[model samples]
Target: MDPADVLNVRFHYGGEFIRIGPSLDYVGGDTAMSVLERDKLSLPELKGFLADHLTVKDSMKIYFLMPGRQLVNGLLFLHTDEGCMQMSEHITDAGVADIYVEYNGEQDEPEEDASGSDFEDELDDLMDNDDEPDAVITAEEEDIVQGNVQAVNAVPEQDILEHILVPNEGGVVTEIISSPVKHNIRVDALSQGSLPRLSRF
Candidate 1:
């Protein structure tokens, strides 16, 4: 995959976190203007790349590399529909400049449980039993399931960005780097109104 397509992307390598940004290019002619060139990837491409490359498991603590080679700790969550969109928005808004992925080794597999086979057999038996009445889930149970789904789908974009932008302890929320042209203006306008300013850096 092209390195220019991703922004502020992180991957685990050799037990360390690696941050990636867009590729740089020079503009044609004598002007000698440097340009940040980024390539865009579709959802399928992104998913496929992640599936093929990422080694760390979901919710793993990973490092994010800053401009000055500073490393900060952050949690890595599995990408969902909302998460993918949020990540894309963050990369664009943050004006990230580099992007790359490296695979150093195979991912560590989860430990096997002794009762796993028995549990699978039981589940299969339950599925094969046609004479048994189907188990009916209650309304409350359905609501609980729906709530869990929503929770999983709700990508905490602000929290993740805040962690990335302001890594020091006791750092003020306002210290985060807001999207210079769009988010900051909207936040300033809202601050002027009845609503208090909610930082979106």
Candidate 2:
């Protein structure tokens, strides 16, 4: 009776996932893992067995996936040897075991270049900038408008002459020319019918 007949084990290490089926009859089978967790397997032997599937260098790290997404690292030799079966039971239902993998690249890479970017520089400058050119133009326009008003107001006043109306026998109205020094007109010598009365409009 072998424990390998009762378990389907899966491991994730060295950027590769290794699945060891219960029997070689399945798609992927590990004859090496079949010998693991037995009383005959040792620490060096397990590491060497893993080396055939993964890069097992000096200071290599190994972690087991536990229940509720917890992780237990292989720190102690004896404890790590036993943790394989214990941790494997937590990941799969009944007798099967597997681990989850994810890439957290987005959350880690943005922290470095966010502050010094061109967009941030432009935004900061826009937020901090201030000045009003329209107000300055309005002030200058007001000064020119005031100067034009003042010039119009300073114009001297001139006397306006009022024309006097004279009535004649011909039933026509005419203006008396009193200011102009000119030749006298012989109105008494002319016939009354020949006298012009109405002024040209």
Candidate 3:
């Protein structure tokens, strides 16, 4: 049989703690797997690597859902073959198989109504509702928006900016504005350089 065709399987590792859920990723290959009882890594040379892990005394072999042809789409190919080995070992150790698997239960999908009653009711409600969203805003909010352009142009020099925005509580938050005097002086200096005799402010 094709390896990929083997979809479901049981695995075992001598340990407590069992975890089972929908596989978030794919695994396969060989490494320190308790199933094969080997410390060194080796890809399961044969399916018996899987069967022994499940602890099947008789012909009751474990089944495994092998990687499908579209391994890329399934996001399984990236996993090292050893990754799968480790995963199976982990799941079996977690008592994933002991929990019991109940088959024949399928999720029911939402069904649409044959009549248009639900659609008509929704349409009528829409027609009856005349409320529009409110346009409430504060004057301070307007000032922030209208002043944003001016504020952006007022970016301070690297040193002063760094001092103002020092890290607090082990995290950094940008300081929007530094000392008013320093800011003004910087702005003035950029616009007008030092003169021979300038009046002190």
What's the TM-score of each model vs. the native? 0.23, 0.27, 0.16
Regions more than 4 Å wrong, model 2: 1-7, 16-37, 68-94, 97-201
Which 10-residue window in model 1 sums to the lowest lDDT? 26-35
With candidate 1 superimposed using the best TM-score fit, by how many Å does residue 111's alpha carbon deviate from the native?
A: 17
Candidate-wise lDDT, in order = 0.44, 0.44, 0.39
Q: 58, model 3: CA deviation in Å?
A: 26
Error of 2 at 36 (Å): 2.6
Question: Which whole-number lDDT from 0 to 100 does residue 131 have in model 3?
Answer: 92
Query: In candidate 1, which residue ranges exceed 4 Å CA deviation?
Result: 1-10, 14-45, 51-76, 97-201
lDDT of 1 by residue, 1-201 (tens): 344454544433334233455432212212111122234434444444445544434443322223333233323232344544444554553454222222234445678865579888788888888896979999999999999979755745453332225445766554445433343334666576533223454
lDDT of 2 by residue, 1-201 (tens): 565434443544424233344321122223233234444344465556566664455554444444443233322222364665455344333453443222122111234655679999888877788854354457889999999889755643322222345656885764453311111133343444344333433
Clashes (backbone N, CA, C under 3 Å), per candidate, total: 9, 0, 16
Q: Which ten-residue region of model 2 has the weakest summed lDDT?
A: 100-109
- lDDT over C-alpha atoms for residue 21 of model 3: 62
What TM-score does prediction 2 earn? 0.27
| Most accurate candidate by TM-score | 2
